[model samples]
Target: MVVDSRSRTRASIVESAAKLLREQGADAVTTRAVAQAAGMQAPTIYRFFEDKEALLDAVAEHVFATYVSSKTLAEDSGDPVADLRAGWDAHIDFGLTNAALFGLLIDPARGGGSPAAAAGLAVLQARVRRVAAIGRLRVPERRAVELIHAAGTGAVLTLLATPPQQRDPGLSAAMYDAVLRAILTDAPALPTGDATAAAVAFRAVAPQLTGLSDAERSLLAEWLDRAAGAV
Candidate 1:
């Protein structure tokens, strides 16, 4: 089937805007610049997005959509640390690779400045809740979620801001060691790579507990792909 030009134009404009935000700062994504980047007129861009704020929200949404890529996440159900290692790896990988998306996500001047920012953040926080519910977080689940979120976000932000040469390897496990470890006190009886290790330490079910539709999982996988190997 032939694609619709208007829909194609709209996607192109949002993509261009996201590109500009990533390449520059969020302040740089004017409709005119996006239109220019899209090879369309400014009014043509306006026809799709209501205004710059709307465009920015779209950009933010797109950024999130990019982070949760598929590929099945190869989850470890045994050791909490193993599950965490996988998640932390995935999380930071997304953050560092999509610096532009990361910028829009963490930067207060961009989507963070908008009223809708809380909604976007809540979407991510909810994901952490899923992980916390896994058996490893024996302490209050809420605090475990908080610690994990703080650690994951902090690590990603630090990685994004820090020069590659200076990033800390120890920082990678900081949240799990400092926070979750307080609850899951036992030194692992199993090895990190053992197939049963992650499961032994964690709940049988996976952490992304939205009962996500296959479509959602597929979208998330694509986003993870953008994060590439940076994490």
Candidate 2:
């Protein structure tokens, strides 16, 4: 088994590789590049990771860990629709908060024989199973959870992709509002304006959250604040 020191070194290398993969596409990520970024020698890098593929597999696992951490699904509340709205709000907040990491999760390249992807997919599957228990899935297809998940992802991507200077936080909040509309089977309409307003609206609804309290929101907000500054 790898000792603590060796394991730390390997984890550092994998983290550097994953960050690079998100910032620059996979083609630009080489073991040598990772070693240089991690401030280690090529042979030392090879000691932990066999090749770019192995490093990528490790990166996939690391990325999936973040996905697992970011599961914001809300269930078991008296109203499934309310639970779903809370879930949508959480999905938007987390996605906007971790835009790059979110991209890695939805990227199609990580499919097929990828242990990292399989682990992440497993988490998603389990979350969907909970939704199934809540009877939130559409009838005949049982894809309500899938549909809700996709809608949440799509709204967040649209919000995050827009330049903060060009658009405004209102757009992001609106996107999230639309997601709630879809999940609740209601007509789509959302507030619009600036990010400050969006932030205010975001905070205003914290009490209504399912399975999450204000303390949890504050803690999560602090974590996202630190991470958002890193980008």
Candidate 3:
């Protein structure tokens, strides 16, 4: 792939900002500092990014991609719950090790606009879908995804806010177990499984079903919701 000069410059700027974040924390990633680190003038950064926040967004994206690339999840492990556990562990580790970047990505002001944050959510949704496919999810897939995300993010932020020596080492694990207890079935979905769990699993993959009109799908979704609530 031929890397153009403009792309190279943008890449250098993002790299510089990422380095600043990783080494000096979030407060140190000023536009001037990033420009100097990248061996470019301050105005050059403006030409690439609208503002410092934009630059930080790019830096978060670059760092996230680099991290995810190094620890790419397997496409499938034949056990969706196990895959979910692996992903939870990786997410906690990533947040702890990249506090500055993680904070930037998880800031409520950014909502779901950050590319890195969206990518992380997509991964969670995919993992949840896998569990739904096997009929083990006890909650709607979206609900399960949201719960896991909230729990994982909250756990990391809480731990980060505490002094290292005072932090409970079991906090993250306990949170994960709590989330699992709320969202998963004791056994895989079977022909004679809990109706609520099975309904929730079916709801997760409902959109992928074929030969259904929009109205039919909507009606089916309502029925699934009612069924899932029976638990």
Candidate 4:
């Protein structure tokens, strides 16, 4: 089938580009190089991708999608906070292991529209939601998500900028702990005196408030979110 053949060709091109990126870094992934690696003409690459940037985008999405797939397939350990920590560790490891691809994925211009990046963020959002549901989250779910995402990104970029031998191995763990202290509570349940924690916990269950109409539920969620973020 023509469609199947096209799909295979596209996949081969992307895989070849990914290989170049991983082994030799992004500078080595030119159209000529990728085409030679894929055993095709450079013109064939144009048939598949608009330009070098487009090809790089494909490579980023392909590699990041594979990583996201693995994360999605992992079983949750039942402890939401522990699960979040595991996700953070995995993210840092991925960034270190795939330095070129991670750099591409984190670029503001390209990453803004990337489906793979969005999928990764969705995974983080789910993890944060679970934490909020269990009453451990002290901030709003969105705030918690933003804080964790920013911290993880900053940690990876910082580590990548440092020489490997000179990098502090404890930096990532320390950053995670600092983020936890900012966004989470010591108690497993909502504490009576902590209005922010109560608001966050309530926001977690706001969707399931079936007795309220949809508009009422939305309004309640808005109020709770505002209250949670007030701290």
Model 4, 150: alpha-carbon shift in Å? Answer: 1.0
Local error of candidate 3 at residue 64 (angstroms) = 2.7
Instruction: Estimate candidate 4's RMSD in Å.
Output: 1.4
What would the TM-scores of all predictions be? 0.62, 0.54, 0.87, 0.96
In terms of lDDT, model 3 sits at 0.85
Q: Rank the candidates by TM-score, best first.
A: 4, 3, 1, 2
What candidate 4 gets wrong by more than 4 Å, as runs, is: none
Tens digits of per-residue lDDT for model 3, 2-39: 45988999999999899899889989999889989999
lDDT computed for candidate 1 = 0.61
What is the number of backbone collisions in each predicted candidate, taken in the order shown?
21, 1, 0, 0
Most accurate candidate by TM-score: 4
Number of backbone clashes in candidate 3:
0
Mark the 10 consecutive residues where model 1 has the least summed lDDT: 222-231
Per-residue C-alpha lDDT of model 1 across residues 1-231, encoded as one tens digit per residue: 246877777788888998898788777899779989999789987777789878878887766655543313355465445555566677777777777666666666553454344443454444443443343334433444566667778878877678989988678667556755654534334335432224322332333546888787656544433332112
Query: How high a TM-score does candidate 1 get?
Result: 0.62
Between prediction 2 and prediction 3, the one with superior TM-score is: 3
Is candidate 2 or 3 superior in lDDT? 3
Q: Which stretches of candidate 2 lie over 4 Å from their true place?
A: 1-6, 19-30, 70-83, 112-141, 172-231
